[model samples]
Target: MAGDNVDGVSTRESLKSALKEIVDRTASVELSGYRDSAEMSGIPESSSKLAAQETSGISGQSDKELKPSPLSGTEMASTTATSSKSKSKSSTATTQQSITSRVETPSDADVRLSSAISGLQDYFRKPCFVHSRLDDAVDVSSVITAMSPDNFSHLSHSSLVRTATGVRELAKRIGQATIKVNLRSILIVTKARDNSLIRLTRELARWLILTRKVNVYVDAKLRLSKRFDADHLLDPSDHELDSCLRFWTPELTSMMPDLFDLVLTLGGDGTVLYTSWLFQHIVPPILAFSLGSLGFLTNFPFQDYEKTLNRVFDDGINVNLRMRFTCTIYKDGHQTETFEVINEIVIDRGPSPWISMLELYGNGHLLTVVQADGLILSTPTGSTAYSLSAGGSLVHPEIPAISVTPICPHTLSFRPMLLPDSMLLKVCVPRGARNTAWASFDGRHRVELRSNDYVTVTASQYPFPTVTASTMDYIESVSRTLKWNVREQQKPFSEDSDGSTTPVNDDEGADDDQLDDDWDIDDSAFFSSSSSSTALSGFNSAPQSAVTTGSSSPLHRDFLTLDGK
Candidate 1:
């Protein structure tokens, strides 16, 4: 307990100091950078970017505002910023006049700077939980409107450069403890024709209904199951438990996301995929259990169902907003269909003997002419699916990039490449191609791309969120399921048992003496003179932003040491 307190304080102070520095530097830069630009542009781009990107999760637009919640300290602070910002917007008409009337002074800037600093300090000081209440989503950028270049009200000089999907991540980054979320309704997805799983599903459903007092929904077909009715005594006539239970179908596509707070999967990865298929648009957060064949996506264990659900409804989940690709097919320049795929999309000559003569276009410019059997466009989540078998590198989910692996290329020099998620990829079945090619979304919904037809693939705003036990579970799955790099112990030799000569390492070279001198060189002794103190101090100073991110903070160090996701 004592050690944890010290570590928590260190993490908090480190994060606070780092964030303050960024705020200080950003305020200075944006004030000087956008002073003149604001005059020409009416309002600074930095200030409007936040409003522009506040698209709701249900709208399939922006990633912000994934959920809605109660009136709490965090939300209150955000609300204050937004309301004041709104009032500031109404007075923008006089911005030019105010700017032209007088020049900004150091004192004025200092006042604005203090306002920004104090606002952040107050918000940061609040305890994470107050009676198990929380803001809908984790949003670090909510209270960032205090620093203004002025003459413009309710305007920020620039926006934060963070792409995080939840406010919990921001809180975690800033050294906050686990907080709770409001979960009222849950929908459980189960595999078909599996009696054991159906029984497990019923068990979970009843618990959620009686113990949790939350509305529970199950597979639409289960309403007809005599076993299901007999278990709850709803088969004969009306019952009180029947009121708590509901049946879910794909027809609830438009309104299901808004009604259901969370989704639970009982079978396995396929059950998870079926959930994805059920909701092609805005998807609710999915918490999966490992009951299927391969448990890659199903990271949670069924044994811990009771504990996991309690924790989930009590303390919120740190959702990984996994990116999905929006693949839209266009024929003769007219949009025909659009489907989102969590895994990679394959475009190859289907059931034909001809090589797929496809042309690749990146962001509307011709990048290459594909002469391979097919091209694999995979998200990092799906990198291990079809991408790995097709020789694509295993990419981490955090990396904002896509895998482009050419499947069975005819050219000897063709190799797999990774493209940025921002790149708009268009693969066309050339009008003069010998035959039509096919495309599939997550190994389902096969669509034929005829001659002169092309499909545009880009990162979708709607990301699939799955509840994970911990980030390490992903790496552990690689070892446990895939058995990555598994091998038998190699033979060991002992000098006493077998007469042998010592072998030198292959890395050693003839110029070992020079390397030794370099390694043994002294720094403080060499820079002992007063004239070299500046250089010494400069050399000793390390950057705050490191490869692990926020290196100056103890929180980041702890994160790295724990192998955090």
Candidate 2:
């Protein structure tokens, strides 16, 4: 046993010495190769020094025992030289085996190489992929070249150039107008299981204080119980509460007016909606930070808080103006109450009544009498919300349009319709209507509507502000967010390709089974291209059409213009 122990110690020492020599030789070879390559490529010699420094830092305490395995030393050295020769080839394909082997080996060299590869991957993947059309290219020579031109009118340019210049000018104006006015207070409202957001909020508050941008006011529920004193000991709970209140709410007379210029919400879309509803009348522009699960509205990433805030303060990024709808409920033909809706306004039967019978009218013309569970009146901004779920078209935000979608109507012919924004919409329950209906705004704030009540809705004067990084068009946002027809590779049958056309399939002749059965009848009755003679009856005929034209169909024209206000 004594002899065996002595032999093991000697072998270990010999291996250690061999590894030290191999490491020294490898380092010398790598340094020389790196220098030669840098000189050949005309790269600065200082870069080699920096790389060496970084490599040394990564090699750390292993410097003393920096050695290669005895069995693999010769093979590894030969492979390393071959790899250097093939460095101009595809790095990924050539380096895979080496990377896997190194990862398996327990050494600082392996860890350093893995870290460098990861850093390279991160650098290559930093920018997002954007798709643009050929006609959308803008000449940004003045901006890119750092030339201070007074106006874009002086330059000869195309329509794309003109649009880019307009955006630049608008950004400049926003920058000039938006000053970092000292905020009187700030409120960070959140719900349960949000410790991560709570910590991030505290850090953001500290950042704001350090920059002297805004005076923050946190909710009383989140205040720390104790304070640190001169001796590094905590003060009494009463003293801490007093100090916190002094900063949060100074005056005792009334709750401090929401003098905050921005309400930075840190939660899901539900949280944003709640905050908007809480201060709907007095709320300022919101900069929502996404910390919850689904973030359709709260888009600002929590990790990039600093960059986002800087852009808001300095660059004046684009803010998407979202429109809201205001609905007034009238009981017995008099305006009784009003509600604001950011998403949509719904008129439906609640738990107390049976299904509803709603009579919808546009500009005093009876469009349809619906027997359904509910009806949704929404602006283009709200089209993507409940309206989409109820089978309405997804209208662009900039388009001046409104959607009327019925929810589970009894008649299959009742389909969603888009109307011009200028039209006034009314939903009323007739005196002999079956059930009582309730009107709600954004799924909250309900008001009971009796058989003799009506709800009228229209576009409101107020618009919500949403901040974005770029001035991409509305269609671009939809395409990216909704993943609509985004192809990973170009197809040969694309419009730009000059390929032979393929033969049509026999299956293409089949009728579309997805169409509703009642749609054909409805189309023939309401939207026939040819004009036909018809009597003008007011909601009395079973199959009479409501649409009319003048001079050609006298009876239809008279019925359409009967009740002119």
Candidate 3:
């Protein structure tokens, strides 16, 4: 109905264009008779079907061929021209809508990228988990090596500064590496005769057997011998353990340290001390749970055992090196006995009515004659223990130093002394004394020192590498466990003559000033040759090394005055 003669154009394109223009012209003119004829034009099948339904009501010319009509050429040309103008307007509207929609709406990827950019600064603003005060105050110079996570072979420098994701990455790396360390055993040492300890041990043992793939060991007597009250912990036979649990008795004591990778202590600080005693030579990492009364060394909490174990197995633990004392008793020039102590070696008058007289010598140099109730030769780790009770300075364990505190000295001038870790100290019960003195290691291994007997204290080659709990380090542990520096209440400020309120801080101010002056003095002079040097063994006379360890990180060194430098 609409195809006119076309000389050069494609038949499909020309026919469709002419049909579209004829349909528009006829529909607008209400020429209903010709509508059916236009619908039958040689257009595509889809367009022809749509036109047939839209013009169904039109009369005449149904299914007619698309040919030049009988109308005059002038009228046909004018109608086709009008239809082309309207067609162009409709096509332009459709194209504009398509372009506008594409530009206004964004893709999912684009939206996500925008969100990430907006939140990037906030992601970096969040602080990483750390003990700010402890990390700041720590003197890392004394630390021979800080046990942290892995280091890439070529990027060893960046490994020292832990990143935000360092812990997680390290845990993954350590777990992969430690997969081969099968039979990683743990030794549990608890306080004796306490129902709580028995219950804890039983629970821990059960957890170990059911959940972990490691071996558990306890004291043989705790599981074998018939104890007074706690029988439940021992009721389960060795067979029930599936060979995953073992025991260490008196006979096997020498090999306990070598067999285990870690020690779990379920008592107070005393439990830690006892555990340290068991491993006389080389102490394993101890995870000391704080159940005892005084828990200075027992930093871990019983409640956090599961989390602590997870970290331990993944090598996420901080191991602090604790210096130990190697004490040897020399009786009549013969080495009579030898032992190791995690804390101090005490020489006191046991059950004697008179004050004990002890001759102190450092590296074969006569130091002084001490007339006191007792003398405490403590390692830096022990400074917070027996030495602190005897008015000794709180020494940082990593400083590589030893403390000597006189207990109830006869004269007020007798003060505590702090010496380098390399120094060899000798405490002698002079040739003739009023009463025999007593010597003890870490408050255990009691021995009597007769006249002319001597006890030598030196830093042990074996150092105790204690596992630090996630909660605290040495400084925080001391503050929390020993309640050090904790005042009951603060006194109100007093008004000065200048109408300014001043804090009523005690003699701590003067002490701070003296400490600064002491940090400046050459401590090498203390070990120098001198004739009239008085023996000092008290907190006030503690060595400068104890107060301000010289070695530290570059940042801390800026604010800290170490070794008078």
Candidate 4:
């Protein structure tokens, strides 16, 4: 690897030297043209031969053919002087006549001087591609001379008549070209709870701005109050923060995802989830640095941030297109509000004594009706989140599927099911339900769903493109996080000096799937898109079995429950 790097550096140095040589040659030719033209202009008109010879030497072109010479200044001057002195009187007369016919309206010296100036202007205006070999190298003047204006005629079809509009369009293209080299913007989101994470964010931001000239955007509140605040309070520095960096608060963060080229999240999986939620519509790619426990989504570590960012900047990494769901609440007919979900949307019995009843409709067809603690409609990207705890399947983020899992469903037959992303889901609260069901989108946008109110779930048009670390992918993340297929250390068969093996414990590793009992506190609150009742008449129809509430006894259900019998 060291040898390869050395070779690469050597090749780059060679290329740089070759390019510098080409540029120096071009500059010299331009400077030489100015000097020769100035010298020729001062000479008397009688010395037309000297003027012609000097002009030829500077322009690097012969009079007969406009073919530029690659000879050095001294060589060109010697060659021109020798040719001029060696020519016979008859040859000189023929040359002067040939020059006269070419410049019929003007003298040979004036025409040649004008041509030389025009050649310099053309060389300066055009772009040049330098060859690696010095022998095959051609200067700017030669390239422009060999190139025919007619060859680029197609570039300005409307300029055939030289119209005012064409001139304006050409000016616009030139202005665009001048501004086309844009510097990319990067947004940094760090975990505020940890001082180390905040410090890392500041260092990363400073490095990006100072080294890459990239614009960095951070939460203004965090920058003002947290790390920045602590820096001033504790160990003060002589240097101030970069003035070029833009600070944005939570209110302004809504505009950030679109303005920035990429997002760098330094924290745990929750930080990435939060960033994903911030971009409710279009989400730029994210580079997540893991600095917290259980970093399923935060693939890269803070220690490897430099290498990880290098890969991202060089576009040497791939992005996983994680699916998100666009959920809307229809109160009557019109949509109340719409929000996006990177994780599961939980519709649960919030602070209610009775279980929440929900009727699920898939693509206008009744899929199921269940009385449960809640219902979770999760995108494949969210399968490993709360949905997993609710007994939902772990789906790969790349899969175009959605999981519907019921939280403590009363019916034993109600199992989590995966459906195609194209399927539209409508979860409605039936009339005379025990209580209003509350819905939350990715643990936010909590709204109360009364009788006849429904919320629709569909795949969002925009997918979140997340960058992963070299260490883990989706499958590895699941294995690492959930400890999937992990087994306990089993004791091999052993005889206690009796030629008999002790009874093996069949219950060993039985609790491998058991999850931590730590209850997740519901601190976040949000609502999905909601509409009015009149707009929801289309979904009022439900399956007969779904509409009926079975009796308390598992076997003795009332068939005529709709009649309240």
Runs in model 1 lying further than 4 Å from the true structure: 1-179, 230-241, 491-565
Clashing pairs in 3: 1-65, 1-66, 268-292, 415-536, 415-537, 415-538, 416-537, 416-538, 417-537
Alpha-carbon shift of residue 200 in model 3 (angstroms)? 1.2
The estimated TM-scores of all candidates read: 0.58, 0.49, 0.53, 0.53
Q: Of the candidates shown, which would achieve the greatest lDDT relative to the real structure?
A: 1
Error of 4 at 502 (Å): 17
Overall lDDT per candidate, in order of appearance: 0.64, 0.55, 0.62, 0.62
Candidate 2 local lDDT, 1-565, one digit each (tens): 0111121222222222222322232334332211213343233344334334445553453432333232233444445546565765756665666655644564544434344434323322321111000012434444445434555446566854776788777445542333232232345555445665666766676566456434455443354422211111223443422322212221200111223445677787777776656544324456778777646676778789888886766654455556667688899889988765677899888875577888888888888887899999987867877898899888876556778999888887889998887787888998888778988888798888998799888766545555555555445546645666777663342221234233333354347556443332223334333444342232346333433445556566665676551
List candidate 4 segments past 4 Å from native: 1-183, 229-243, 470-472, 488-565
Better of 2 and 4 by lDDT: 4
For 145-223, candidate 3 gives per-residue lDDT tens digits of: 4343332444445654554366556434422232112225678887876765776787787677667766677765555
Model 4: per-residue lDDT, tens digit, 1-565?
0011121122222222222322233333232211212222232332333334444443454433221232333433444445665774556666565544444344443345444434333332221111111112234345445345765556565554455565456434422221111225677887766777667777887778766776677665554455555334212342343434665444334422334557888888788888877776666667788787887787777887777676566654455667788889889767899887889889998999999888999999988787999999998878888898999998877667989999999888989999999899999999978899999988877899989999999888666767655424877877887898999786675443535344344574857439553324321111113454543542366445544555644223543553466
lDDT for position 80 in model 4: 49
Better of 2 and 3 by TM-score: 3
Candidate numbers, best TM-score first, in rank order? 1, 3, 4, 2
Residue 10 miss distance in model 2 (angstroms): 82
If candidate 3 were superposed on the true structure by all CA atoms, what would the RMSD be?
A: 38.1
The C-alpha stretches of model 2 lying farther than 4 A from their native spots are 1-187, 191-193, 224-258, 352-354, 363-365, 473-482, 486-565
Clashes of 1: 4
Q: What is the lDDT for 368 in model 1?
A: 90
TM-score of 1: 0.58
